[model samples]
Target: MLENYLVRGLLIGIVFGVPAGAVGILSVQRVLSQGAAAGLVTGIGSSVADVFYACIGVFGITIISDFLLKNQHIICMLGCMLVILLGIQCFRKKKVEKPASVSHKKQEDRHQPGTIRYLISCFLSSFAIAITNPATILSFMVVFSMFRIGGNESIGEDIQLVLGIFCGTCFWWLLIAVVVSHIRDRVTDGFYLKLNRIFGILMVLFGAGIGVRAFMV
Candidate 1:
């Protein structure tokens, strides 16, 4: 029974994380611009938010869920504005100069005080963006219902499911970070700049869509 719940949670996590939405684009952009660590940290933030919503779904935390649902419009509008600001920042970013020394660049990517601060910023931004989406909990609830997950279950089983979800989400993000980081060295400055702009535009569109949905609700 625990195994079944774990498997279901894993599937749910992967399904939710696979979408190339704003979070996905931000992950890719961070990997290309910053480093694998940055991308992984960003994804970790998102995974944390997923776990928060998953807990609400699995544990049936009605009060918090209801509050989020009730104020979804305000929350979504704030998220929309933040996302658009981020998009504009990305779009207007100056081109980075390629490091003349590959080995030196690799060394520089290692964690330092400044890098730690940057990673923290990345994590917070992604977390804030992800958590503001009240729809995340709804998605979790719907998927939980489909899997028959949340009724009369042991606390142990619910914990296992949430753990599985966190692991699954982290695994997906790790794969993304590794793959994108591997190719990061080969990408040219011009190509990186172009991708940043394209991703920025996409993120803005995504934010606009979210705003429209907020109004519809």
Candidate 2:
């Protein structure tokens, strides 16, 4: 029972957490009081929350799920507000320097999002921000429910699954932090500001779109 729970949870976590990292780290990287640090702390905090949600799904908290569905419109609206905030921040900054003589291929990638706080703040914001998407919870529910943990998934076995999932999330986050941290040093502040603006505008657009959608609903 223990082994089955461990293995299944491990596989499920790896499958979900790795991809989730791409989304998670990027969000954390966006709002950078210090990019990398923010990514790290927020990522870890979110990882904890992810584990909690996994446990909830495994335990069958249908009521909680139902409640979330009921208030989904509100969630979307909140998400839109965050996006507006993001948009304002981005356009405020200036552009970066030219390419290495304008003949090289260095323009595609600018700021590396080095500030640790930047990334972590993104992560922390994402705890709620990620949830705002609505689908995020469903994704967790679907993934965990597939495994079915223990025999009837006793509490212990369920917990094991959550643990495995947390471990997987950890692996994904650490990998992102390392990658971002490494390249971050090479980028310029101008590039960072530009990226922020682009993301910010896009965020505002998406947010406003969602908010409108909620009203329509």
Candidate 3:
């Protein structure tokens, strides 16, 4: 039974994470430009948020869902604004010249994200953006309903389910980071910059669409 739950969680995570949405694009772009660590951390942050939502779904937490649903328009507006701002920042970022280095090892290390700013940007910002998506929670609710979870279930079992979800999510992010890291060195910086601009434009468009939908609602 435990193994079954774990497999289901893994399937759910893969289904949720496979979409090349704003978060996916951002993760890849960060990997190409900032480094694998940045992309991995960003993906982890979003995954954590997803796990949280998964927990809520599995536990049938109606109050929180009700509150979010009630204020969805406001949340949508804020999330869209933030997405637009981040998109603009990415679009305007100037490429920095690489410094002359004595060793190949040093040059390699320079590409990885190590700064506090990058960590915070990748982690906290990703969390914020991910948590703002009420649709994710709804999707989880649908899945859980299909699986018949959240009905007089033991707390321990629920916890195990949530843990399974977290693990599954982490696994997906790790795969993305590893795959992207392998190709990070081969791609030219100019290509990354152009990719960033494209992603930025897409982000802005996504935000605009959300904003329009919110207003219409």
Candidate 4:
């Protein structure tokens, strides 16, 4: 029974994480520019946020869940705006120039803030976005219902499920970062620039769609 709960959790986690939305694209771009470690760390932050929402769903935090769902229009609008801003920044970012020497590369890295700062920035940003998307909690609820979750399970069962969720999300993000990092050296500067612009356009479209939907209601 415990194993079954864990398996269900893992499957649900992967399903939730698989969408190549704004956050996914951002992580990919970061991997290509910063390195796999940075990207993975950023993704971990997102995964942690996912777990938090999952907890809310499983524990049946009705008050909080209802509030988020009721105001989802505003939340969606704000999230879309934030995503659009990030897209624009990505689009405007200068193409990375290859350093002529290893020493130059090391110096550049030294000039930047440490990994902790980068991870914190990514965590806060991703958490903000994830929390605003009330659909995530809905998804968890649906999946739990499908699995016949009673919300009366023991603490042990919940822990197992949460662990499964964390591992599943980590697995997906690690795959992304590793795959992108492998091709990072091969991708041309122009390709990265184009990628940014493409994602930027996508973000704007997504935001516009949300705005239209919100206003239409």
Which candidate's lDDT is highest?
A: 1
Residue 90 displacement in candidate 4 (angstroms): 0.9
140-181: candidate 1 lDDT, tens digit per residue: 878888878756889988988898889889888899999998
Q: Candidate 1 clashing pairs?
A: none
In terms of TM-score, the best-performing candidate is 1
- The whole-model lDDT of each prediction reads 0.86, 0.62, 0.75, 0.76
- For residue 158, model 1's alpha carbon misses the true position, in angstroms, by 0.4
Displacement of the residue 130 alpha carbon in candidate 4, Å: 1.6
Candidate 3 lDDT tens digits, 3-41: 667766776676666635567777877777666777888
- By lDDT, the better pick of 1 and 4 is 1
Give the lDDT of residue 44 in candidate 4. 81
lDDT of 4 at 1: 86
TM-score of 4: 0.87
> Whose TM-score is higher: candidate 3's or candidate 4's?
4
lDDT of 3: 0.75
Worst 10 residues of 1 by lDDT: 94-103
TM-score of 3: 0.86
lDDT of 1: 0.86
CA deviation > 4 Å runs, candidate 4? 97-113
